[model samples]
Target: MQHGIHPAYRPVVFRDRVGGLTFLTRSTATADRTVEWADGTTRPVVDVEVSSASHPFYTGNARVLDTAGRVERYHRRYGRGDGAGH
Candidate 1:
C-alpha cells in the first residue's frame, strides 16, 4: 500500500527436476528459465527436486520398514535369553 518499494509480482513456473513435472503458479520467486505454456505464453520456469507426483506418500508407493526383523535380530544378539521379554 506504499510506493514503489515492493518486488515485482508475476507469473512463474515450478518444475520438478526428478519427475520432470511442471506447473504454473504465481510467486515472487525469480527464475532463470522460461517455457511456453498451454496458453501460448512464455513464463518463468523453476526446477524442483520432487513433488507430489513422484513422492511415495502421494503416489501410494510408500516404503515399509523392516522393524520386525531388526527387533528379532537385536533380541538374538543383545536381548535377554530368558525369554521374559526385555
Candidate 2:
C-alpha cells in the first residue's frame, strides 16, 4: 500500500431508484448528493438504475431469451454460410 496516492475510501450509500433499495458499503466513488441513513447519519448517496433488489435475474423475473430460435431465424433469412466458419 502506498501513502497519499490513493483515493479516499469511505462509507457510501447506493440507492436503487426503481426498487427503492439502499445499500451501505465502502467505496472510493463520490457523489454530490447526500442522504440520511437509518442509523441517523448522513452519507454520500449515489443513485443507480438497477441493483439486486430489482434486477430480473436476482428477482426471478428474468425472461429467458430464445437465442437458438433467433439464430435459426437469422440463418434461414441470411443463408447461414456467411463466413462465420460454419
Candidate 3:
C-alpha cells in the first residue's frame, strides 16, 4: 500500500512464437520491443518460447512416460531381491 515502491503495472502483449498466439494483459514486466495489437494500438510486446497454446499439457499433446517398462528394466539389471536389509 506504499506509494513509489511498486513496479508500474501496465498493459502488455505476450506473444507465443511457436503457437503464433498473442494475448494482451496487465503486468509489471516490460520489454523494449513493441507491437501493434488488435485494438489498433501499439503496446509493449514480449516474445515467449512456450505458452498454454503450445505447451504439451495445455494442448493435450503430452506423452505418457512408460514407468512400468522402466521398472522392469531396472529389476532386470539389478535383480528383484527381497529387501532383507541387503
Candidate 4:
C-alpha cells in the first residue's frame, strides 16, 4: 500500500477489431485511442488481435493437430535415426 508508486488502474476498453467486440474492464494499461462505451463514457481503447471472441480455441474452431502425419513426414524427409545414439 504505497502512495504515488503504482500505476493508475481505471476502466479501459479492450477492442477486438477482428471480432467486432468491445468490453470495458479495469486495468493499468492505457492507450492513445478512445472509444464511447455503452455507458456513454469515453474510455481509453486498446486494440487487441486475439480475444475469446476471435480466438479459435475459445470459439471451438481450433484445428486438431495431426501428430502422426507430422511424424511420418519428418521420417520421410529424414530417414529415421538408427537405434544407436548419434
Candidate 5:
C-alpha cells in the first residue's frame, strides 16, 4: 500500500438513529462529528438510516410479496399474450 495516497483507516463509530444503536468499528469513512465511546475515547461518528437492528430482514419484520397473485392479476387484466385470442 502507498504511504500517503490511501485514506486513513481508523476506528469510527456508526450510529443508527432509527434503531438507536451505536457501535465502534474500523473504517475508512470519516465524519465531521465526533462521539465519546464507552472506552472513554473520542471517534468520528457517522449517522446511518438503516442497520442490522432496523433492517426488515435482520429484524424479521420483512413482508412477503404476493408475486403469484400479481402475475395472475396481470394475466387477467392484460391477457397472457399467447396470441390465440387475438
Candidate 6:
C-alpha cells in the first residue's frame, strides 16, 4: 500500500492475434500501443499470440503423440533378430 512507487494496475486491452478479438483485464504490464475498448475508453493494448480462449489445446486441437509407437518402430528396425516382418 505504498503511495508513489507502485505501478498502476488497471484494465488494459489484450488482443488475440488469430481472431483480432480484444478483452480488458487488469494488470501492471505495459504495452507499446493503446486502443479504444468496447466500453468507449482508450487503454494500453498488448498483442498476444495465444490466450485460454484462443489456444489450440484449450480449444481441443491438442494432439496425442505416440511416443511408444515410435520407440517400438525404432527398435524393430535396428535391433537384432527375433525379427518383426517389415
Least accurate stretch of 10 residues (summed lDDT) in model 2? 77-86
In model 2, how large is the Cα lDDT of residue 34? 100
Model 3 C-alpha lDDT per residue in residues 1-86, reported as the tens digit of each score: 89999999999999999999899999999899999888899999999999999999999999999999999999888878678634
lDDT of each: 0.86, 0.95, 0.94, 0.91, 0.95, 0.85
Q: Is candidate 3 or candidate 6 better by TM-score?
A: 3
Q: If scored against the real structure, what TM-score would every candidate get?
A: 0.77, 0.74, 0.84, 0.76, 0.82, 0.74
Give the residue spans of candidate 2 off by over 4 A. Answer: 66-86
The lDDT, on a scale of 0 to 1, for candidate 6 is 0.85
Model 4 Cα displacement at 65 (Å)?
Answer: 1.6
Model 6, span 1-86: residue lDDT tens? 98999999988888898866778889998988998877789899999989877887888988889999988898788774456643
Pitting candidate 5 against candidate 6, the one with the higher TM-score is 5
Model 4 local distance difference test score? 0.91
Clashes of each: 0, 0, 0, 0, 0, 0
Cα error, candidate 6, residue 82 (Å): 12
Model 4 scores a TM of 0.76
Sort by TM-score, best first: what order?
A: 3, 5, 1, 4, 2, 6
Displacement of residue 77 (Cα, Å) in model 5 is 2.3
Question: Whole-model lDDT for model 1 versus the true structure?
Answer: 0.86
> Candidate 1's residue-wise lDDT over 1-86, tens digit each?
88798777888988888777789888889888799988999999888888987888988899989999988998889875778766
Model 5 has an lDDT value of: 0.95
Colliding pairs, model 5: none
Q: Give one digit per residue, the lDDT tens place, for model 4 in 1-86.
A: 99999999999999997988888899999799998888888899999999989999999999999999999998888778776644
